[model samples]
Target: MSSAHYDCTLSLTDFCSKETERVCKLICLITSTGTEMLSPTGFVVLSVALGFIMTFGFVNNFVVLLLFCKFKTLRTPVNMLLLNISISDMLVCVFGTTLSFASSIKGRWLLGRIGCSWYGFVNSCFGIVSLISLVILSYDRYSTLTVCNNNRWPDYRKPLVAVCCSWVYSLIWTVPPLLGWSSYDLEGAGTSCSVSWKVRTAQSHAYIICLFIFCLVHYAASDICM
Candidate 1:
C-alpha cells in the first residue's frame, strides 16, 4: 500500500478509538447519575407513598398476628392459611418494603448490587408465597363450603400441607433468577429492583414466560374458578 494510504488508515483507526472511548465515558456518566432520573418532587411523592404502605401494612399484619396469638379459636385450618398469608406480607413489609421506602426517600438504591439482589429475591419470595397462600386459602374456603353443605368435617391435615407447599412452590420460582436463569437489576427510575423483565435473552424470556404462566395466570384462573 502507499505511505499516504497507510498513514490515512492509522489516523482513521485512532479517530474511531478516541470516539469509542469518549462514548463509553458518556454512557458511564449517565448510568452512574441514575438518581437524577427522578425530580425532587417525584422522590418525595414516592417516599410518602411507600411510607404509607409500609406503615399500614406492618400495622395491619401485626394486628392479625397478635389476634392469632392471643386467641385459641383463630387457629383453625382455614385461619392457619390466613396466618401464613399475613406472615408473608408482614415480612415483605419488613424485609422488602422498608428497603424500597428508604431508597425512595434517598432517591436511589442504597444497598448497591448485592443489596439489590437481596431485595429482589426476598420480595419475590414473600410475594409469591402470599399469592400461592391466597390461592390455597380460596380453595380451602371453597372446600369448606362444599363440606358444610354435605355435613362432613373438613380434613385438618390438608391446610398444613398446603401452607408448606406454598413456600416451596414460591422458592422454586424465585430462586432461579439468583442462579442466572435471569437476574435482578434496578428498574423503574432506578429506585428499586426486581426480576429483570426487560432482558431480551432466551433464558430471561423463558423464565418470565414460565413465571407468568405458573404464578400469575394460575393465580388468576384459581380466583376465577373459585
Candidate 2:
C-alpha cells in the first residue's frame, strides 16, 4: 500500500472510537448525508448555521480587502504587509467556504487528493507567510523606531520579495510532512504539520535551546529599538 498522511487507524480506545464515530454519524444524519430522522427541522438548522459561517467569512474578508485597497495612505510598509496578509486570509475563505460548508453539511471530504493537496499546500503557504509577516511587522516597527528603517520611497520590491520568500519557506517546511519525512499527527480539527521541539529530555533539549537562542536575538533587537 502507498504511504499516506491520513490513515484509518483503530482509535486508541474502544469506547472513544465508537463514541466518536457515533457522534460523527449523528452529525451527518442531522445535516446532509445520513438518514435525517427529525425530518426538515434538522435540515433547516444545519443549512442556516453553515450559511452563516460562509457568509460571515466572505463579507468580512471582502470588507477588509476593499478598505485596504481603497485607501492609499494605509499603503505604508507595515500596512501593506497587513493588506497582503488579509488577502491571504480572504483567499482561505473564498477558495474554501463553499466547499467547506458543503463538506460540513454532507459530512465527508468531497475534495479528493487533488483538492486536499491543493488545500493543504495553499493553506500551509499562506499560514506561514501570515505568521512571518507578523514577525516581520514587529521587526519593521523596530527598524522604524531605531532610525534604521528601509527608505520610505517604498521600494515596493522588498515586500514582494518577503512575500515570495515567505511562500518558499512555508513550502519547504510543509512539503516534507506529507512526503513522509516525519510523522504527521493531528492535534485537533485543523491539520498541523508543524514540528515543534520540546525540551523534555536531553536529546530534544538542544534543539529547543537553539530555537530559544534565535528568538533571543530577535527579542534583544526589539528591546534595543524600543
Candidate 3:
C-alpha cells in the first residue's frame, strides 16, 4: 500500500478504537449508577430475604455434598446427580446470589462492569446447570421405574458425562451475552445484573428469544424422556 493510504488507515483505526472505548465508559457509568429501586425498609427486607436464600441454599447443598463425600453407599449414580445439583446450587448461592445481595444492600453496583458481567455469567450458567441436573435426575428416576428388566445399575461415568454436558449447555446461553450478542446490565432493581432483556435492539431480542426457545425445547425433551 502507499504510505499516505497506510497512514490514513491507521489513523481511522485509532479513532474507531478510541470512540469505542469512550462509548463503553459511558455505558458503564450509566449502568453502575442506576437509580435505587427500593426504600430503606424495602432494602432491608430484600437483604434479609437474600440472606435467607443464600444461607439456606448453602447449608442444604453443603450438607448433601458432605453426606455424599462421607458415605460410600450414597455415592451411586443417582446420588451423584444430587451431588451435581448441590454443587451448582452452592455456586449460585455464593457467586450468584451473594453478589446480587451485596449490590442490593449497597443500592448500586460497587463491583463495576467486570463484576456485573461475571455475576451475570455465573448466575445464568449455574442456574441453567441446576435446572438441567434436575431434569437428568428425574429422567434417571423415571427410567428406573419404567425400564423392563430394571436389574442393570447405571454406572457413575454416565452421570458424570451428563453433568459435563449440562455445564457446556449452560455456557451456550450464558457466554453469548459476554461476547456482545446482548449484554448484562443492572436490572430494574438497580443492584442485580443479568441479561438485558429490556433492551429493544435486534441482537438483544434475538438472544432473548433464542434463550427462551432453548429452555422450552430442553424442558419438553426432558419431560418426554422422563
Candidate 4:
C-alpha cells in the first residue's frame, strides 16, 4: 500500500523473474548439449537398418572377392571393375556404415572431432569411388555392347587405367573438403560426419553445388548408359 513498500515488492518480483529466466536458459543449454535430436525409436530403427545393410554388404562383397580370387576366369577386366566396386562397398561397410550403425544405436557421436573428420573423409572418398566405378562400369558395358560387337574383350590395361583414374578422381574431390576448400563436420543427430553443406560461406556453397551436380551427372550417366 505504501510507495516504498510497493517499490521493494517490485524489485523482489524482478529478481525472481531474472533468476527464473537464467535457470530456464541453463536448462536449455544443458539439454541442447547433452541430448540427441532423434527419438529412441528413430535411433533404434536407424541402427537396425544400418546393421542389416552392413552385414549383408560385408558378407556378399567378401564372398564375391573370394570368388574372384579363386576363379582365374572370373578375373577379367569387367569382373575386376566389379571387384573394385565391391571392395569400395565393403570399405564403406567397414569404415563408414558400421560406425554409423554404432553411433546411431548409441544415439550420439562417440568419436571426437578427429574421428568425425576421418569418418567424413573415408565415407566421402569411398562414395566417390563407388560412383566413379559405376560410371566406368556403364561405359565398359556401353563399349562392349556398341563397339565390341565382334566378341573381343578389351585389354586389361584399359580398365586398369580407368580404375586408377577413378581412385585419383575420388581422392581429388574428397581432399578439397579436408583441405579447407569446403569443409567436413558432424551432421544429422550428431552421429555422423559429412561435408558441411549447411555452412553458408561462398566456398562451401560452391563445393556443395558442384558436388550435387557431379553426383547427379555421374548417376544419371550410369543409369542412362546401362
Candidate 5:
C-alpha cells in the first residue's frame, strides 16, 4: 500500500479504538451508579410507600392473628381460611416487603443475587398462598349457599386440609424458578426482585405462561364462577 494511504488508515483505526473505549467507559459508569435508573426523590417515594405497606400490613394481620388466637368462637372452619390468609400476608410483609422497603430506602438492592432470589421466591410463595386462600374462602362461602349440608366435609378437617393445600400449591409454582425453569432478578427501579419476566427464552416463557394460567387465571376464573 502507498505510504499516505497507510497513514490515513492507521489514523482511522486509532479514532475507532478511542471511540469504542469511550463508549465502554460510559457504559461502565452508568451501570456502576445505581441511582441513574431512579431519581433520589423517586426512591424516597418508593421507600415511603413500601414502608407504609409493610407497617400497616404487619399490624393489621397481626391483630387478626391475635384475635384468632385469643377467641374460641373465631376458630370456626371458615375463620380458619381467614387465619391462613392473615398468616401468609404477615409473612410476606416480614420476608418480602421489608427487604424491598430497605432497598428502596437505599435506592438499590443490597442483598446481591442470592437475596434477590430469596425475595422473589418468598414473596411469590406467600403471595400465592394468600391468593389461593381467598379463592378457597370464596368457595366456602359459595358452597354454604348452594350445597347441601350432606355434601360438605367435616368443618375443621376441611379448612385444615385447604390451608395445607394452599401452601403446597404455592410451592409447586414458585419452586420451578429455583430449579432452573426460569430465574429471579432485580426489577422495577432496581429496588425489588422477582421472576425474570423479561427473559425471552423458551423455558422462561413456558414457565411464565404456565404460572400465569395455573396460578392466576385458574384461581380468578374459579372465584368468578363460584
Candidate 6:
C-alpha cells in the first residue's frame, strides 16, 4: 500500500499555530472555526487524504505557474489565461478544500451561515474560473487560425480582458449556490462538506446541466488540442 503524504496522526485541527490556540483553548490552531465533529481516527483519515491530494495538486499547479512565469516563449495570451486557471486551481487546493475540511468537523458549520455561503460561493467560483479559463484558452488558440480575425490578442490588455471575463462568468456560476439555490451538507464527518447533490430546486438542475455541457465541450476541446 502507498503511504499517506501527511502525518494523519496529527490531523489539520490538532496541528497547532499560535493564532487559534490563543483564542479558543479547546479549539486547535490554523482552522476557520471551532467545530470538531471528527473522531481522531476520522480526522486522521481525512487529513491524510487532503494532504496527499493537495501535496500533488499544489506542486503541479505551482510548477505550471512557474513554467508560465519563467518561460518567455510561453507568454502568449492563451498561456496567460491558463496561468489564471492554474492560480485558481491552486487557490482551491490552498483555501477551498483545506479550510472547508477543517471547518466541517462536528457536523454543524462553525463559520456561521454567511460564512457557509461564502465558502460554497468561493469554491464554486474557483471551479468555474478554472473551466472558463480553459474554454477561453481554447478560443484564443482557435482565433489565430480564423480567416476573419481582424486582431489577435497581442498584449497584456487582451489577456487581462479575457481574465476579467472569466471572473465574470465564474461569478455567474457561483452566486446561485450561495443564494441557497444549491445546498451544503456536512457529510458524515463534521470536518467535511459538499454542495447538497440530493436536494434541488429548478435552478439547481439547470446549474448542473450547464456545468455538464460546459465540461463536455471542454473535454472535446482538450481532446482536439491533444
Per residue, candidate 1 scores C-alpha lDDT tens digits across 127-182 of 99998888888887787677655536655798889889999999999999899899
Winner of 1 and 5 under TM-score: 5
lDDT of each: 0.84, 0.55, 0.80, 0.80, 0.86, 0.66
Q: RMSD per prediction, one decimal? A: 7.2, 9.5, 10.3, 7.9, 7.2, 12.1
Worst 10 residues of 3 by lDDT: 1-10
The residue pairs found clashing in candidate 4 are: none
Off by over 4 Å in 4: 1-36, 149-154, 222-226
- Residue-level lDDT for 123 in candidate 5: 94
> Better model by TM-score, 3 or 5?
5
* Model 3 lDDT tens row, 1-226: 3222222223344434765665444444544444436677787888889989999999999999888888888988888778888999999998988987897788666788899899889988988888888888888888778877545775788899999999999998999999999998887567788888778899999999888788657666766766
Best by lDDT: 5
lDDT preference between candidates 1 and 6, better one: 1
Candidate 1 clashes between residue pairs 3 or more apart in a chain or in different chains: none
**Poorest 10 consecutive residues by lDDT, candidate 1:** 1-10
Give the lDDT ranking, best first: 5, 1, 3, 4, 6, 2
For all predicted structures, in order, the TM-scores are 0.82, 0.56, 0.80, 0.81, 0.84, 0.61
- lDDT (Cα, tens digit) per residue for candidate 6, span 40-92: 67666777787777778889999998888788998876678878988998988
| TM-score: model 4 vs. ground truth | 0.81
> Clash number for every model?
0, 0, 0, 0, 0, 8
State the local distance difference test value for candidate 2.
0.55
